[model samples]
Target: MKQVLVIVLALFIVGCSSTSKVALSEDRFLLTSNDPEYGYTENKPIELGGFLRGTKSAGAHIEYFEGLMGPNGEKVKVTRLGSCCEFEDKSMPFGGGLLDRYQLTYEGQKKPVIIYVNLYKFNKPLAPMGFALL
Candidate 1:
C-alpha cells in the first residue's frame, strides 16, 4: 500500500507540472495586413489589417520602417519590422520605430481586432537639404 500511494503521488505531481508548462506555452501574438497601400503622409493614418493573440491581459508592440523608392515613383526598400508583445491591456496605446503609432479595433467579441498603424512618423529625411514626401 505504501508503494502504491507513492506512485500515485508522483504521477499527480508530474501531471500538474505538465499542465503548467502547457499553459505558459499557450501565450502568443498574431499580426496580419491586407490591401496595403503605402504613401508618404504628414500625420495621415494608414490602415494595417491584422489580429493579435496570446494577449489576454496585455497588448503587443509593432514596428514600422520606410521602404526604398524606385525610379518610377514606387517604394522598393524594405526595413526591419518591429513587434509589440505582452501589453498591459488591450486599451493601452502601443507604438514603435519611425511613425510608430497603432490603433487597435476589435470586432464584436470573438473576432480578431484590426491594427491601424502610421508608418511615416518614424522615417528620417533622405536629403540633408530638404524633406520630400513619398
Candidate 2:
C-alpha cells in the first residue's frame, strides 16, 4: 500500500508540472506555467515570441522596468499601453487569475524583450517579466 501511494504521488506531481500549450492563431501561441518563475532565470533578453501566460497580477509587477534593452545593449523604449484580464481566478491573491493581458509599445523594436515576472506579491520592484516586440 505504501508503494502504491508513492507511485500515485509521483504521478500526481509530474502531471501537475506538465505544460499546456494553446494556439491563439497561426503565428501566436500561448505558453502557460504553474510556476511563475518560468522564463525569468536567464539574464539575457528574450526574443519576442507570441505571448506569456502566467498570473494575472503580472501587470502590477510590470511597472518596475524603465524599458527593454536591445541585443546590442541599447535602450529600447517600452510603454505599457493597456492590460486585459477577462479570465481570472478569484482564489488567487490580488486577483492574479488565469491570464493578465498587457499591451506594450516598443520603440524601434523589431524583436521580443525578455522580462522576469514577479511571482511574489510582496516584491513590487522586480526584473523584466518578458516582452513582445511588435
Candidate 2 overall Cα lDDT vs. reference?
0.36
**With candidate 1 superimposed using the best TM-score fit, by how many Å does residue 86's alpha carbon deviate from the native?**
20
Q: Model 1 over residues 1-96: C-alpha lDDT tens digits?
A: 999999999999998755422111111111111223222232333422222443321121232223212222222223323443222323334533
| lDDT tens per residue, model 2, 1-134 | 99999999999988765422122232211222223453343322222322334655444443333433332234445544333333333654556422222333343456653333323333323223332111
Best by TM-score: 2
TM-score to native of every candidate shown: 0.21, 0.29
> Which residue pairs show backbone clashes in model 2?
48-112, 89-97, 115-128, 115-129, 115-130, 116-128, 116-129, 117-129
lDDT of 2 at 51: 33
Candidate 1 residues lying further than 4 Å off, grouped into runs, are: 23-134
By summed lDDT, which 10 consecutive residues of candidate 1 come out lowest?
24-33
Candidate 2 runs further than 4 Å off: 1-63, 93-108, 111-134
- The weakest ten consecutive residues by lDDT in model 2 span 21-30
Looking at model 1, residue 30 earns an lDDT score of 11
Error of 2 at 56 (Å): 17
